[model samples]
Target: MRAWSGQWRPGEGFGEPLPAWDGPSTLVLVFASPAVIADDTPPDPGGPLAGLLEAYPASVVMGCSTAGEILGGTIDDATVSVAVAQFASTRLRLLTGPIGGGTDSAAVGRDLAARLVAAEPDLAGVFVLSDGLRANGAQLAQGLSDGCAGTAVITGGLAGDGDRFDHTWVLVDGRPRTGMVSVLGLSGPHVRVGHGAGGGWSILGPERLVTRAEGNVVHELDGQPALTLYRSYLGDRMGDTAASTLMFPLSVRAPEGRQGAVVRTVQALDESAQSLVFTGDVPQGSIARLLRANTGELVDGAGEAVRRADLVPGLPTLALVVSCVGRRAVLGQRTEDELEMVMSRLPADVHLAGFYSYGEISPIGEHTSGLLNQTLTVTTIQETAA
Candidate 1:
């Protein structure tokens, strides 16, 4: 496989022209800043993607808006990051569908998975990008995992609108749109895919039982208003729940006979209802603990994730790093440290491309895929000789 990656700014086109490839590209992943995607003003509202489409017109183009864009070892905001891959023995297919609302997320995932499996019976792996704000990430991941039934590895993340949590967009066929989910299916014996996730967050305070909850919305914890209990932990920083909560996400343990404990970050707060809406589900009767992490722990976690991915050494590989927007908010100026750590841990010939997302989708154990937040998720792809 041959890969090329570069960044594009508003006024500064792509820093340089795409390197000429001997063969047609197989997949093009485009991660753009929300600012570039939301600028639907007049001429060229399509932003930098127009150039990308013209460059890889035949490739399966897919990606989403991000809290921050990542290319190679560098991280930047308000810019577009593009990665084009030409695989020798891999076959690719793209599937997309509308997500009417949060409740429709699971169904949409199942449908997408069914279509992809039917189209490619030997489906090797599936990477997904979904509407971050409007879709229930937990349900979507579950549906995809169940639908695939251990046939393929599933990895990807939700689109992000930076820290706004207001609007997010997904790119399908080089067009950015809202309330949609896109799946990229990879198949062929030579296509190798590996994924790993890590979060070095420490639990704070005592664990509380989720007394009342519905899907991703938690109304009460240990019989206390969920938002109120969470505010106690935030204290003075409770003013901006959406942004502040990123610093302290929740560690939720699902009910018995289900996926194990996973991280959940606040997506919104209902002041009137005294509830907290998380990026993933916090099931009623489950245990919830607040989590906090220092810079060292977070950076180490990134390296640990790469170690977990276990990519083969000395192979041309593409590593897609989907980190949480919360991690970016907490890392601040040191955000690049995690990205640099990822690059250092990966193979020397690696092409790194990804974004900070609203919610990260990765497998927790074996074939059990789960939606994660405030965690670093890595998906590596390489094609061996046919």
Candidate 2:
């Protein structure tokens, strides 16, 4: 794979990423955080992607707007940022459709799978990107997972807005929107892919059963207000509850499909109402776990991510990391140290790129990897010989 990057000032138009890419091999594009776009920008404008499409043209492109972007695993700023990589062995295919708020993900999945399967190429993995503005996150993630089969793996994230939930934009075809998802199906014998996550959460106390729920909103838990259980855990930090825990979500997976959880800050807490107001819907009868973070744990997790990126079993074309924003916060000022560890520990000289995700969608443990909750996650892409 080949890589390219560019930065634009605060009021710049969507333009090609610096160092135009011109190669016959297929292209797989990964992008960094997109800011609050200038006032004159169109609602669903191509934005920074205008330049990306111009360069790759037929190459399959997929990524999300982020709170911040890391090109080749480094941060870029207030201007647009781009990292383009070329893979000579893999075939890249792109797809997009309505996701969240009344959409058929099963159909969307099948359509994507059919296109990928027809190619019958040895699989590397599927890269998915989402607009993290709504509750349909899990639904859309499942749709893409179901759509592709016989694939090496799937990795990506729910785009973030620094800490603002309302500032997400999904890559639609080549455009950006609030209610869309973009996926790139990469299949080839030479493509190498591996993923892993850090370990530390010791399930504290018995699991809290979900007494009532909807989509991502939990009105009640164990027949009591959901917030009450949460507060019980918060103790002195109750004042910092929702805002502190907004990026963390209860993650679950059924034998049937993948699940993604991203909690918005609490909307309201009513004891008499026996309800909890949530920005996203949470189904009743789901489990809720108190998410916790320790400085040491977060840094160690970065090493785990690097281990996966380096162990992918082949020559890697590039490494794209999709980590939970919650992890960054937990580490605080020490976050840069984590970045340094990741950049240095991974196999030397691999082009690295990634973004802090609102919710990470990379695989780690075989059982519950796809939809990680409030944890650091990593994914690596490369090439392997037959």
Candidate 3:
């Protein structure tokens, strides 16, 4: 695989958007600030991106935004940083659109699946960058399964505004937008994708009941107000502050008969409303877990995930990472430490790129409900055959 990335100087960075990319490639674009793009107001209709894709002839280009960046050990927002990978033996395509809940979400998925199946590529799977605020995260997955009628894997995360979901954006031809989701379709016979999630939290109690909830807001648990339940979970240790709730996480066990328990970060707590604001929706009647992230544990888990993949014969030529922005909060100034820990396990020469997400999407041993949190999702693809 051939992978590389550099800045986009408006003056010198001349090319078609699609052409910037190369063949059998998966391009990871870490889009810089929407604020920056809006203020500077450069000529971005078709963007250099089209030329990029035309240049590289990519299999897919998957990317999102970031509160921070880590490329070659240098992290900054000024970088229109990008990473590219070329799997010589692989063929791929990118599928994108916005799909809401109810019928819209299913429809979008079916349409995308139809196009994907029509291409009839080997179909490695689908990577998604979505609007967590609106899109039925699951419907897209289900639609792909039904429409495509295949067993390709789906992984990625909610394209969001760091931890603040109040305003999130997606990029289309160098433009930033809210309320839209992007999907990248990948096809290849030989590919490596690794994913892992641990809130650095050890499960607590025998598990508590989510007595009342709506979407991501938990009103009550164990018959008590959800706020009270949360307080009891961490005790006065929260130090009597409003934002203190940020330190604790909700470990939600999917309704009965499901195999995933996701760590949803607490974004806010309303005293008057007696409600808890979470990253993703928590349906009523869900079992709850109060969790924490140890700096070392977060980094260690990420390291282990990459190392586990490293055991494969050939080194990974490219890497795409989706780590929860919430974890970065827990890690403080040492947030980069976790990323570095993950990088430490990779070969220095293996090119890579990614973005921190509001919520991460990754398969848990091939499960249907695979979007998750406080974890790093690493996808690696290398040609195993000529």
- Candidate 2 on 319-350: residue-level lDDT in tens? 67666666665566776666666777776666
Which of the numbered candidates is closest to the native, going by highest TM-score?
1
List CA RMSD, all candidates. 2.5, 4.4, 4.1
For each candidate, the alpha-carbon lDDT, in order, equals 0.84, 0.59, 0.62
True-structure lDDT of candidate 1: 0.84
Clashes of each: 0, 22, 30
TM-scores of all models? 0.92, 0.80, 0.82
* CA RMSD (A), model 3: 4.1
Highest lDDT model number: 1
Q: Whole-model lDDT for model 2 versus the true structure? A: 0.59
Q: What is the per-residue lDDT of model 3 for residues 226-327, given as tens digits with 9 covering 90 to 100? A: 777677767876745545755666778756744567677676778897788775667788888676656787777777667645435555566666677777
